[model samples]
Target: MTGSVTLVEVGPRDGLQACKHPIATAARIGLIERLRKAGVKRMEVGSFVSPKHVPRMADTGEVMDAVGSRAEPGDMVLIANARGLEQVIAHGARTIAVFTAASDAFAQKNIGCTIAASLERFAPLVETARAAGVAVRGYISTITDCPYSGEVAPEAVVPVARSLMEMGCGEISLGETLGRATPCRIAAVIEAVAAHVPIEALAAHFHDTYGMGVANVWEAVRLGVRTVDAAVGGLGGCPFAPGATGNVASEDIVYLLHGQGIETGIDLDGLLDAAAYCGDTMGIAPVSRVFKARRG
Candidate 1:
C-alpha cells in the first residue's frame, strides 16, 4: 500500500488573504464547502490576524462560523498571536497555526517583531491551544532564501522548528516563502531539522516562483515528510516577500502524487473542479499549469 499523504488546502485562507478585491463572505464559505467535497481533509478556513493588517480576512469570525458550522473534522485556522487564537477558539476552531520565520529580517518586516520576540509571543498561544485540547501547527517562513536577506542558512530553520515543538505544536511547516528553494537546499534544511524533530512531524509549504514547488515537495517526501500545504488554483503569494509566486497548486500536486502511485485519498478530478470554481468565482485565471493545461 502506498503511504498516506495529507494535503492541507490553504486556498480559503491564504488564497483569499492576498486578493486585492473583496471576495464576498458567502463566496468564501462556498469555496471551503467545495474543497471539503473534493476530499480535502484539512483546510485552513481563515486567519485571526488583525483585520487592519489583513482586511481581506476581516471576516475571519464570520468565515469561521459559516465553515466551522459545517466543518467535517480537521478544518482549521491560522492564528498569528494570542488574540488571533482567542478568536478562533471562540469560533470553535479545532486546529490553529502559529507563524514565524526562519530569517530574523523576514519576521521583523512581516510581523514587526524580532524572531525571538515572535517565538516568545507564540508560546502563550501554544500553551492555550494545549489546554483547550486543540491541535497546534507551526509555520516557519523563508526556510530557504529570503528576498530581503538573500541566502538564509539551513541551520536557522532548526531552532524555530524546535521552539514550536517545545511549545506544543503537533507539526511544523517549513515555508519556501520566496519560492527560491531548490531540491538540494530543501534537503539540506530537512537534514538539519530532522535531527531535532521527527521527519513525520514536519510539513512543507512551497511556492512556484521558480517553478520548483513540485520538485522540492518530491524531495521532502523522499526524505520522509508527509504533510504538504498547497493552495487551490495556485492562489496565494506573500505580500511582504517581493516577487513571490502562488503556492504549489493543489490539483497539480495531487496529480503528481497520483502519478507516483501514492494514494492521497483525494479526488484529483474533483479538486480540479474546485480549482476551476475558485478561478471563476475570483475572476482570475488560475495559476495552476495543470488546471490550465487540462482545460485547454
Candidate 2:
C-alpha cells in the first residue's frame, strides 16, 4: 500500500443521486469544483439517463457543460445506452462509464435488462466510444452479493469483466453494492476476475452499509488494485438495492491510504472542507469517520 493509488470521486453523481430531496445544479457544480480544488483528478460528475427515471441527474448535461472544459481526462458521465452516450458526447465528455451486473436479477432490476442483454447493448456503445476517441469505463455491480439474487459467485464476474475489457473498456470497476462484503469475499471476486482480466485494469467500488467498505478497499489494494471509487462525505447508495448505504468516503480512503504510506495526492484538509460543504448544503452531516473525528 506504499505506492500511489488513483481515487475516483463519485459524490456529485452517485452520491447525490440517492438523496431524497433534489440537489440543485449549482450545488452539484460547487461540490465538483471543491473536489477538483482538493486534488481530485478523476470523478463521475454526472450521468446521461432519462430524467423521469433519475430526476436527480436531470441536470447532467448542464453539469457537464459547466465543467467539461476543466474536467480531467478521467472525469466522465455514466451512460446506459446509445442515446445516453450520444448525449454525453455532445456535451463534450472525454470519458464515459457503462454499468451492468454479474447477477441477472440485479441487472434486470437496476438496468432493466439481463446480463447478456446488457453486454450486447454495451458492445456497440463501446465501439462508438472508441471511434469517437472517448475512453470507456465499465462497472459491474453486485460483484459480491446481490439484493435480488443474494450471494454471487466470484466466477460469475469473470466473463462479465472480460466482456467489458474485450469490448474496449479501459477500466473495470467491481462494485460491492450491498456493502456486506468482507475482505475474504472481496479477495475471492478480485482473484477470480483478475485471473481473466489484468489486475491493473480493475478498480474497487464499495459501500459502507455493513461497515466493511474501508476493509474491503484495503483488501483490494493489497491485491494490486490501483483505482478506487469513492464519494466525498460518504455520499451514495444503490437506488435499486434495498437496505444498501452510501459509498466509502473519499476522506476515509485518503486517511487510510496516507496512513499506510500510500499516496493519493489529495489534501485531507481540503477534502474535509469539501465534505463539510456537501453536508451543509444537503442539511446532513457527513458520515465519514475521518470527517467526524477531525471536524468534531
Give the winner by lDDT. Answer: 2
Candidate 1 lDDT, 1-296, residue by residue in tens:
26878999998888778887888888888888888888999988889887887888888789878776334458778988777878877888889888889999999999889889988998888898889978899999999888788898988989899988998999999999988878999999999999999999999899999999999988988888999999999989988888997989998899888888887889987888888887678775688978988873
Give lDDT tens digits, candidate 2, residues 1-296.
47999999998888988788988888888888899899999989999887888899999888877776334676788999889988978888888999999999999988999999999999999999999989999999999899987899999999999999999999999999999988999999999999999999999999999999999999999999999999999998888999999999999999999999999999999999999998778765789999999996
- My TM-score estimates for the predictions, one after another, are 0.97, 0.98
Model 2 bad stretches (over 4 Å): 69-71
TM for candidate 2 is: 0.98
lDDT at residue 187 of model 1 (Cα atoms): 95
Q: Which candidate is the best by TM-score?
A: 2
